[model samples]
Target: MPEKNVPTSPPTCPTDLSLIDSTYPVGVPLTATYRLGFAFKTINLRLPVILTKIIDQLSRDKNEIGESCGQEARDDVKIVVGALAKFKNEMVTNKPIYKTGCKIWDSYLEHIAQLYFEGVVEDVKWYFAPWLHVECYFYKRIHDAFQLSNHLKSFDPFRKQKEDGFECSKKSSAQLAEYVLSSDSSDAVLQTLLEVGLWGNRCDLSLSSGEEVSQLGNLVDQLQGLRNFVLCDESANFWKILKDAKTANPDNPLTVGYVLDNAGFELFTDFCLADKLMDRVDRIDFYVKTTPWFISDALKTDFDWLIERMCSGDCSDFPVLVKLAERWKGYVLSKRWTVVESEFWTYPHAYFEMQDADPELYSTLTKHTHLIFKGDLNYRKLIGDVSWKPDTPFKDALRGFCPAPLLSLRTLKADCIAGLRAGLAEEIESKSQDWLVSGEYGIMQHAQ
Candidate 1:
């Protein structure tokens, strides 16, 4: 969304992913080795553009950033901007990744060296490394830029883009708010809202590399047409899981956990679903990133900012929006909703690594009756970002990471996928070349 202010036009990744004759064997980590692959485009083009936008924002907002932080704001902005500019060059030239030397990153670097570099991290370059490790490292390095500054240690370069994205979706958000608040809790109604939230994943800015995107028109009314685009649906299974949990627990209150994804409209839809979910669960724990991530990923600050904006902003025309916002505000105030920040969420490891890497967080997650993970990046992480066979069962792809019954509401923005019917991926690929990474398709897959 930074108005072509970067040095070059952003390069586009191909949406198509050929089903058979894969360049890598099944279960291999995805990398940019496939020249036409999304990872290739992302590393070469999209990532640099994202960095350029940050540099532009910092340069443009120096005074304002200075005013908010301290007298050192301008100098802090310049420092981060220069760092980011250098980082962008590193990415574009496919330079070897270096240690930020931050305690957390250094520890994770050891892990990465073991997995991909065989203890020699100097061998890990930007392009050929596992897409997940390098992409995550990309953001971590960006955070390190600000982290080194005296006044900008806590700055978030993508905050305004996330807020602007929400503003763009306000009308559609009000519509969904009214619809959900007024609807009954029937299974059919819940299914509709679930689909709405699933489609909301399409609005992710990180997929667009910081470009603006949002929901449009009445969200619910468009669902009938969007149905076929859902590659797999387990909404009925999701509802049954909730029902069974409540029934089996009887005297106990069911607790749900949300491993949230992007901010803006997708996050707004997440709140709408959570509002409905409260009827079946006693408490909902919302997991958030401890720092800025993947450009648009939810942070505790993003969550708080949304709620404040909803409550205090002019919503007189959509009274129900504010009404629901107030209820959500109270949920946090009264402890019905809890926001959790953990370094584990930002670590450059797959979900399967959780048990050994962060057992305490894994154990805490085990206490939940169900966990809902949102968006494409979480889906990629859940499956280890491996190139599995098209028809691989979702549970099998999980590599034993199940801490509780979980559902992933994801729109396909990456080439990797699991839990498709035999021949389904081939069938879809035959019809549309862009079927894999277009964000035009989605899945609501559940696993225990």
Candidate 2:
């Protein structure tokens, strides 16, 4: 099939280089720079054909097709990578000029560029959609910096807060257990987990401690309504599956695998969900990225360091706090009775490439697994990160790609949401131009 179409016009580059040069200081906050960088990155990485569609749509003053929008957004990403690659080539002859961060960024850019040049873009586009691409870039940049700086890792802002959040949940899990036992409905556990999930999103560690605490409380309060909204057919089916699993093997532990996203409050929320699961099941395991200090939440596997930081009460250096919050949202939704780790995130290859680079992780995922892919990042991976029709069924969107049972629980943090009912796409368009791409709405799908 042809790649999804997108707009084609070249994005207007900022004339002032000073805008890019402005540094964010410790106290004075400026999110605009990052947002601009994100936009630029998005426009650069889009496929050329998709870019043409976007230009066509924009020229005609029509809404861009799903694929076109994705391509246009990613086009800037391509430019950024290209520029960095050029910078890297220049560095071979002109050393002592580029900063360590830039150098690392260049290396990652080169890797991505190679992927694009090798005609792997189509296969990997699903995995490297703009948001996921940005995330991967962020991690690689940090990894490169650490390598250059005597292997010194940076502090993640979310790590300490997430540890504290987990501890708090541990203390409250008994209370949650009491509530679960008192309420006879299976939805009780799901409801509590939903509240915990929302809290995870709000209690973002990137923000100040005070802000994080306040958001946590707010999310906790909103659980009752979210619970009511979740009483659909899927909810009923989920409970049925759980019941059958319990009946078949009373001694068998229910495994809840968390495809983790970001660190901090989200991580804390994930811990809370895990604690709650222990009330219903037998064991819990978590999977996280194996990289150094990249995205905050991916560092959850490094629990030892997180615990120490929480004890010392120092968490200020971690960047990408908002992304961490988004990932936490995914983490909260995946909890069940027992949790197990999935090593896919930590592996270097894409999901399709996993069979060769990390067959063990792939094999483990295919066996006795029900994956909860969290956030837009995982969604990109699940759907090959390519643009698809808005009305595509979730399973069809995956195109028979996934090997095991899986569900995508994502708040539309980025463009490229799929698996909508026929009119659902129209409804979103009529109500708000940004609805499909906005993070306000969510999707929950199961792949058998």
Candidate 3:
């Protein structure tokens, strides 16, 4: 369980995120230079709080962790805590971000220089570097602190938070499972599951800085109520694509790839979608992070944990969970559902760069008929974390990344976005100026 007393509330800041001015060119990477922007607030406020929580979680779980991993792990816990404290200080103090001399990261810096900067850049600071790179680095360094340890090298500081998040959402998960299990393979059911998976992006722990969050009530029942909030509804297009693919390849095996996001209710929603998709698609491939990332990204362990709990735990109140879990287990055992991990996912590179950065993973992705990318971070990478015009076409914003026909089901949580119709962004801003950074609104954007 997570340390209940650890305070992870975000510090109060300006609610009107649009008030922050951006001086970068239209296609430049999002940096924290804009004082009032979400990137800046994330660096100066949210990330440090997240780091503090990691430190606090370590301290609280000291005894249990030690017992599990042995005495060396206990001593290493103090060391990791101290390292995290120093890391928090570095971020809070606006210290320069240094390159890890590792080949992969250093090459990425070179890639950034060749692509974004004109090559003479040197110092990368917490408050001024590219938001995506620095943010990923922050997590990488946290893992580094443990990777250097003896007994705690495999320890996931974020495990408890991920577990607690799932526990909190079991009610909604069971409800969603039952809804899917009882429903027919209708377009309505598919659309409902897609929206549920989209809204599930809102439960991200990184967005909340590790605060407990849950999916509550009847999620399927709430779909219509939240329909208007979908800024871009490409579901009709999505359905057409699915229909075309199924009709054209009736004999050939059809596969779908899910570049997964948060691990709890969001992951549960992902499973619901995958379960629904299995009726049409032959195989499902789930790509998870190799390490604990951005607080709640699913690791292979988290993927297994949820399934194991559902399969073995007392589900008297929600037997459908066990039924669904057993079915999913059979799918896994039969290789109908495969869990995949790649170092490419943890890298800071954008999706467009995948061909050059990790060709094998890119080749693997091409075999899938369509890729469903979930959450804000994946959306950011899809567009290279650049600030495109609000009305920019999603494909144009992709900058030529077409691994497969892809759909990004993302709740707006950052300043960067694309594929809004003319004047749509402004009209939404008139209602809620903070809509860009707020998770209230969403987009089901498609790109081919």
Candidate 4:
């Protein structure tokens, strides 16, 4: 890698830099940075909180975690603690980054240069960098710390939280499972499950600073009350797209793919929704995180674990859950429901970069009838983490990243939004000041 000197101040832009609040260029630093601003709090507080928690976990002895995986565990605990302490210090001091041993670290260096050349920020310091870039970078560094460990190479610091959260959600899970098992293919059931799945996103752990969140309320009853919170409901169109494909070829079922998000209750709701859609679609592909990420992002282990938990007891204890699990297991065994992991999902690249950066992955996605992107981070990447006008056409904002018809099931957790009616944002603003950052609103946005 070529060396470049860090400037004493931010560099001037050589290329056009967007300033519109709705569509501000993501890489560029906002002027008059506030001490308590979202970016500042995220870097100074949230990131450190997660890092400190990681260090705490690593510092734990094998006896503390309730397992003695033997000397391998002890050696790894020592190595992991040392690495996390170093990484945590770097974050607290806003130290200049050292290249992590990740393969993409070199590419990240190239991006730093690209950001400088485009006059984005002074350097890639955590506090000054783009939220999408810095947040993803932080998680990658966490992965690296574990990767450097021998016995703990595949250890997930977040695994216990994932399992515990699901355990907490079993009541909700059983209720939904019972509903799905006894329910017929009524459109009401479909819509109810769809809305239930959307609200499940509110239980994200990353947004709550790594805390375990569960779904407690009656999901079916709450759907009507939560109706107004849906800012854009192209849900009918989402079902129509699937319905049309099924109508076209009753013999050949449509292929559906989900770029899934957080685990626990959310994944359970997603499974419930998928169970209902199984009759309409031949196969449902779940694209899970290859690595533990964003505190609670779902992984292959999460998927497998959830199934095993549901199927563990005899059908008498929780008959509906066991029945649903048995059906899901059957699907997995027959290759009708497949779980896919792509390292590409872990990369920081925006959706638009998919065609140029990972065409094979892009081509693979094209096979799906609809590629459903779930939750906020995926939504941010889909829209390039920009400040596009609230009403920017979803298709236009996508900038030709559509390999297949896409539906984004996202709760508003960031300032960026697109595809709203002309006056809807103002109306929302009139009612609530921080509606955009709050998880109170969501959208089921569809674009081909």
lDDT of 1 by residue, 320-400 (tens): 788999999999998999999998888888999899889999999999989999998899999999999979999999999
Instruction: Superpose all Cα atoms of candidate 2 onto the true structure and report the RMSD in Å to 1 decimal.
Output: 15.1
TM-score of 1: 0.94
Ranked by TM-score from best down, the candidates are: 1, 3, 4, 2
Where does candidate 2 stray beyond 4 Å?
1-135, 151-186, 202-216, 224-235, 292-294, 301-352
Candidate 1, RMSD to the unseen true structure: 3.7
TM-score of 2: 0.58
With candidate 1 superimposed using the best TM-score fit, by how many Å does residue 74's alpha carbon deviate from the native? 1.3
lDDT of 2 by residue, 212-237 (tens): 23232335445555443221123344
lDDT of each: 0.85, 0.44, 0.84, 0.77
TM-score of each: 0.94, 0.58, 0.93, 0.89
Error of 3 at 325 (Å): 0.6
**What shift in Å separates residue 439 of candidate 1 from its native position after superposition?**
0.4
Worst 10 residues of 1 by lDDT: 1-10
Residue range 133-199, candidate 3, lDDT tens digits:
9899999999988976788888888898888888888888888898989998888888889998999
